[model samples]
Target: MKFALSLLVGAAAAQCGKRSPSYLTWTADSFIEHGVEKNFHYTQATLYLGYEAAYELTGDEKYAEWYRNQIDDAVVLEDGTIKDWDYEFYSLDDYRIGNNFLWWYERTGEEKYRKAADIIREQINRHPRNQAGGFWHRRPVYPNQMWLDGIFMADTFYAKWTKMFDNDNTTAWDDILKQFVLIDSHTRNHTTGLLAHGYDESKTAVWADPVTVNRDSGSAPLVWDRAVGWYFIALLEAIQLFPESHEGHSILVGFYKDLAAALKKAQHKSGGWWLIMSEPYPGMEGNYIESSASAMFTYGWLKGIKLGLISKGEYYKAAKKGYKLLTNRFVRADDECLLNWEGTVEVGSLCCNGTYEYYISIPLQTNDYKGVGPFMLASYEWETY
Candidate 1:
């Protein structure tokens, strides 16, 4: 009787605190404010997505306004170009935030927002590509490189951009399709049906294959946590953007669903994914269960299930368990606040890190943005469904 009463009380308490996830509740445990080397982290898209999600869930005007300000701040006015990017040395990673501009433009009728998005999209168009029609991750500075992580970094943003204003641009659609084709060609390992961490287009870098130019960066070669997270999220976002009439929509959705199934299979039983996804030899450095990647997988699975791309029974249950483990052990939550998220989650690389220790060795810091947006997104999905 006592146990039942306690359970009831706990349940009631949970109900009382249940609210759709809001970025307002999330305080950056560490901030890049005041010129603190902000460029080191991939900014823009993920951060603005947090604010956009907050606006959607809470109807908070402040987040919407702040996001608009961020886009305005990032505009680059060099010699002759009114651009949102420095393409000579830029990565597709930053443009993901461009999706927010369209929504803001719709809300405010601001051509500047639309213009800013156009500028970014144009930058994507004008940027250098490798021999096979794939983007060169950033500039030649990151020469001969194409990380699996780069797929979500730009392509999802590209799809959203196309959805917004390129309904008539057949060439734009062709470009988007080509981008995916290039990624599928470079990263997809036909044997395991998983992505390698990245590929070196030139095969010249130390991490590159001297023969094929692919990055033989990690062990197992099954999949990596963060890299796979990028793939799943890209599929989810891109699928959402796909027009119903497109012949490829169903195919992409099927791929996403299958990827989710594969990911569920790879999830560590303790409710996370290993740094290196496949079962590994005993001495791998960072192959243990990782936090951000686990949270991302949980977010992806929950989002996929809620989006009707996957079944709820198993995916939902797994997400719930993963959330529990994250909140109970990995997360430092007090009074509805989260702290100490694992900041740098990189794996499937034989170079710098691929062992369980390397994954865990990336310091658990307060409110890293990598986990923040995804956790908030997952929580919002939880609240809704």
Candidate 2:
């Protein structure tokens, strides 16, 4: 979908544009996840996988160009030992991006891709660690806090980097394994079979659980859609990097299966997942379906099947149902050619406390990157499906 970066409205329309076309355009800002203006940093990492996938699928140079732009952002000097990117700015939260860059470098042998990947290695070289040596989510701020989001962002990058710059760098694997240990130790909900949004080691945030040592970062226990979506992608991405012989390999595979089983129970009767997972009561307020989260799940499940990570029989059926629902429910056409995409960030939201009212209140919009990118990737994954 073409990202709408601009819009036109008459004086009367501008006053009542809520009744008119309210659109979002392509931007360099990273906060366009749900078509919202957020204070998050836009890392080329998130776009990297989508761009590479797009390039290979469309055979278009523009996708390659987009990949190049991300490289440009990270490339620093003659030797990529130092990069222009500030480690203090954001941690490896976007590290999966490096795998894309490295893949591009391997494809073209462009020194910059290699050099840029090397620069990222340096960031890992100096990354701060927790007491168990788990890398902090970001440097210079939020020390010792491990966000579930960071695992996919960093581990996928590090694993591929290990194969590249220096296969001899066993420390990379150690770091990767330790990160899983830290997050699973802190965030796993044994009974519910889902992960919390993020974990704070210092217990500084008001959200941090004082007793169990976890954090209450995700607003709704209903499984914040995009947050878990980020995680699901991360899990598959990490699996690609591991050896079947690795100790965590089986454990991680089982983890994926168990999570999917739980998620299956939470899916909406209409084929999507409820805004507040684990509880979608009829005639309820917040217990409803969401777009982005559902799409992300669909994409991940399909990819998992392709990777041989799940039983194709039942899981494939669930995935197919989700695909039909997403395309039918979330997608809308535009004749004006001005706007062409839409996605609901989630069906519900929660704050103050998790409730039905909280789950269904999340705003929905079109062409949200969180939904669009994944949708494009998922569509490309199963064109025949």
* Local accuracy of candidate 1 as per-residue lDDT tens digits, 1-385: 1001111322322443523322233422222231112221354456556566667777867666555555554442223234434546577667665666667767887677777668778888777887767787777466546676777878877888888877766676667666665655666655445555666666655545432223442112335667777777888888888776775577678667767777776666677666666545212553356566777788888888878888888788899887765554454334443333443343233344333454445544445566656765665666566
- Model 1 is weakest, by summed lDDT over 10 consecutive residues, at 1-10
| Every candidate's lDDT | 0.60, 0.59
Candidate 2 segments whose C-alpha is farther than 4 A from its true place: 1-44, 65-84, 94-96, 139-141, 210-222, 278-284, 336-339, 344-365
| Tens digit of per-residue lDDT, candidate 2, span 95-155 | 5556766786788886877776776767777788877677777766667777666777777
RMSD of each: 6.4, 7.8
Task: Score candidate 2 by TM-score against the native.
Answer: 0.76
